[model samples]
Target chain A: EPEVTQTPSHQVTQMGQEVILRCVPISNHLYFYWYRQILGQKVEFLVSFYNNEISEKSEIFDDQFSVERPDGSNFTLKIRSTKLEDSAMYFCASSDLGYGYTFGSGTRLTVV
Target chain B: SQKIEQNSEALNIQEGKTATLTCNYTNYSPAYLQWYRQDPGRGPVFLLLIRENEKEKRKERLKVTFDTTLKQSLFHITASQPADSATYLCALVTAGANSKLTFGKGITLSVRP
Candidate 1:
C-alpha cells in the first residue's frame, strides 16, 4: 500500500533558528494535513492544505508557521523561529475523498 | 470548551482475551468519530470510523461503538495478540466541510502472551 513519507526522521536545531519539515503525501491524494504530538500529550492539529492553499489552522499554527506545496509531490512546514516548546513529533497525513487518512512515520523535532 | 478524555494509564490484558478501551468527550457533538492506532515513535494508523448516526462498526477483530447520547465511544479488540499492543486514539470531527478533529490522549494497551 502507498503511504505518506517524510524526510529527516529526526532533527535537532538551535533555538531561534529556522527549520523546515518536509513530507511527500500519497501521489493521488488531494488533501494534506500536519499534526504534532508533544511528549506525553495528545496529537494536535497544526494545519490543513488543499489546492496548494491552507484550508484551516489552529492557534498553535501562529505567525511562525507556514506550509507550502512547492512541488506536485512535496508538502513542507516551515517554522520561522524554533523555541524549546516547539520540540515535538510532527506528522504528515493525506486523504482521498474523505476516506481514512494515511499518516507518515513522523519527524521528531528537537529544539535546544 | 470541548474536551476529550481517554484513560491516561496503560491497560494490561492477557493474550486471547478482549481489550476494551473507552473515549469520552464533553461540550461538543461530533458528526463522526474515528479510531487510530499508534506504535511508539510512529504516526497514528487509521483503524475505523463511526458516524454519529451509526451505533456501531466493526472490521475483522476490531469493533467500535458510538454513543452520541452518552458522548462516548468504546473500542474493542477481541482475540488480541501481543501484536495488538499499542496506543489507540479516538478522534471527533465537528460539523463542516473542513472537518477539523479533536483527539483524546490515547490509551495504551499491553497484551501479554
Candidate 2:
C-alpha cells in the first residue's frame, strides 16, 4: 500500500530559529492535512490544503505557521519562529476519496 | 465551541474479554465519527468509521456504535488480546464535504493475558 512519507523523522532546533517540516502525501490524494499532538494531549488540527491552497485552519494555526505545496509531490510546513510550545509530534495525513485518512509516521519537533 | 471527551484514564481488561470505550462531544454537529489506534511514539492508524445516519458499523472483532442524538460514540472490541492494547482515539468530522477533523484525548487500553 502507498503511504505518506515525511523527512527528518526527528528534529532539534533553537527556540528562535525557523523550521521546515517536509511531507510527501500519497500521489493520487487531493486533500492533505497537518495535525500535532503535544505530549499527553489530544491531536490538534493545524491546517488543511487542497488545490495548492489552504482550505481550513484551526485557531491554533496562527501567524507563525504556513503550509505550501511547492511541487506536485511535496507539501511542507514552515514555522517562522519556533517557541517551546511548538515542540510536538507533527503528523501529515492524506485521503484520496474521504473514506479514511492515512497518516505518516510523524516528525518529532523538539525546540530548546 | 466544540469539545470532544474521552475517558482520559486507562482501562484494564482481561484477555478474551470485551472492552468498551466511550467518546462524547458537545456543541458541534458531526457528519461522521472515526476511530483510530495508536501505539507508543507512532501516528494513529484508522480502525473504523461510523456515519451520523448509521447506528452501528463493524469490522471483524471491532464494532462501533454512533448515537447522534446523544452526541456519543462507543467502540467495542470482542475477544481482545494483548496485541489489541493501545490508545484509541475518536475523531469528529464537521458537516461539510471535506472538513477537518477534531480529535479527543484518547483512552488507553491494557489487555492482560
Candidate 3:
C-alpha cells in the first residue's frame, strides 16, 4: 500500500527558532492536512490544504503557522517561531477521494 | 462546545474475547465518523468509517455501529488477539465535505494472550 511519508522523525529546537516539517503525500491525493497532538492531549487540527491553497484552519492555527505545497509532491508546514508549548507530535495526512485519510508516521517536535 | 468522548479507562481483555469500545459526541452534527488505531509513537491508522445514515459497518472481525440519535458509535473487535492491542481513536467529520476530523482522546485496549 502506498503511504504518506514525513521526514525528520524527531526534531529538537530552541525557543524562538523557525522549523519546517516536510511531508510527501500520496501522488494521487488531492487534499492534505496537518494535525498535532500534545502529550496526553487530543489530536488537534491545524490546517487543510487543497489546490495549493488553505481551505480550512482551526483557531490554534495562528500567525505562527503556515503550510505550503511548494512542489508537485511535497507539502510542508513552517512554524515562524517555536514556543515551548509547541512541543508535540505533528502528523501529515492525505486523502484521494476524501473519505479516508492516510497518515504518515508523524514528526515529533520538541522545543526547549 | 463540541466534544468527543471515548471510554476514559483502558480496556483489558483476554484473548478470544470480543472487545467493544465506545465513542460519544456532544453538540456536533457529524456527517461521518471514523475509527483509527495508533501504536506507541506512531500515527493513527484508519480502521473503519461509519456514515451518519448507516447504522452498522463491518470489516472482518471488526464491527462499528453508529447511532445518530444517541450521538454515539460503538466499535467491536471479535475473536480478538494480542496483536489487537492499541489505542483506538474515534474522529468526527462534520457536514462540510472538506472539514477536518476532530478526534477523541482515544482509549487504549490491551488484549492478553
Candidate 4:
C-alpha cells in the first residue's frame, strides 16, 4: 500500500527558532493536510491544502505557521518563532476526493 | 463548541472475543465519520469510514455502524487478537468535499492473548 512519508522523524530546536517539517504525500492524492497532537491530547487540525493553496485552517494555524506545497509531491509546514508550547507530534495526511486519509508516521517536534 | 468524545478508559478484552468502541459527537454536522488505529509513537492508520447516509459498513472482521440521529458511531472488531491492541481514534469530516477531519482523543484497546 502506498503511504505518506514525513522526514525528520524527530527534531529538537531551541525556542524562538524557525523549523520546517516536511512531508511527501501520495502521488494520486488531491488533498493534503497538517495535524498536530500534543502529548495526551486529541489530534488537532492545523491546515488543509488543495490546488496549491490553503483551503481551510484552524485557529491553531496562526500567522506564525505556514504550509506550502513547494513541489509537486512535497508539502511542508513551517513554524516561525517556535515556542515551548509548539512541541508536539505533527502528522501529514493526504486523500483522494472524499476518501479516508493516509497519514505519515509523523515528526516529533521538541522545542527547548 | 464542537467535540468528539470516545471512552477515555482503556478497554481490556480476552482474545477471540468481540471488542466494541464508541464514538459520539456534539455541535457539528459531519459528512462522514472515520476510524483509525494508532500504535505508540506512530500516526493513525485509516481503518474505515461511514457516511451520514450509510447506516453500517464492514470490512473483513471489522464492522462500523453510524447513527446520524444519535450523533454517534460504533466500531467493532470481531475475534480479536493480541495484534489488535492499539489506540483507536474516531474522527469527523466537517467540510463538504474537501473535508477537514477533527479527531477525538483515541481510546486504547488491549486484547490479551
**TM-scores of the models, in the given order?**
0.97, 0.97, 0.98, 0.97
Name the better of 2 and 4 by TM-score: 4
- What would you estimate as the lDDT of candidate 3? 0.94
Q: How many backbone clashes does candidate 4 have?
A: 0
lDDT tens digits, residue span B1-113, model 4: 87899966589999999999999999989889999999999999999999889999999999999998999999999999999999999999875736889898989999998
- Per-residue CA lDDT of candidate 1, range A68-93, in tens? 99979999999999999999999999
Which residue runs does candidate 4 get wrong by more than 4 Å? B95-97
lDDT of 2 by residue, B3-109 (tens): 89886569999999999999999998988999999998888899998888999999999999999899999999999999999999999887873668788999999
Runs off by more than 4 Å, candidate 2: none
- Which tens-of-lDDT digit does each residue in B2-67 have in candidate 1? 899996569999999999999999987888889999999999999998988999999999999999
Off by over 4 Å in 3: none
**Residue A39's lDDT in candidate 4:** 90
> Could you give the DockQ of candidate 3?
0.78
Candidate 2, residue A69: Cα displacement in angstroms equals 0.8
Model 3 agreement with the true structure over A26-92: per-residue lDDT tens digits: 9998999999999888888999998999999999899999999987899999999999999999999
lDDT of 4 by residue, A1-112 (tens): 9999999999999999999999999999999999999998888999999999999999999999999988698999999999999999999999986699999999999999
Per-model DockQ = 0.76, 0.76, 0.78, 0.85
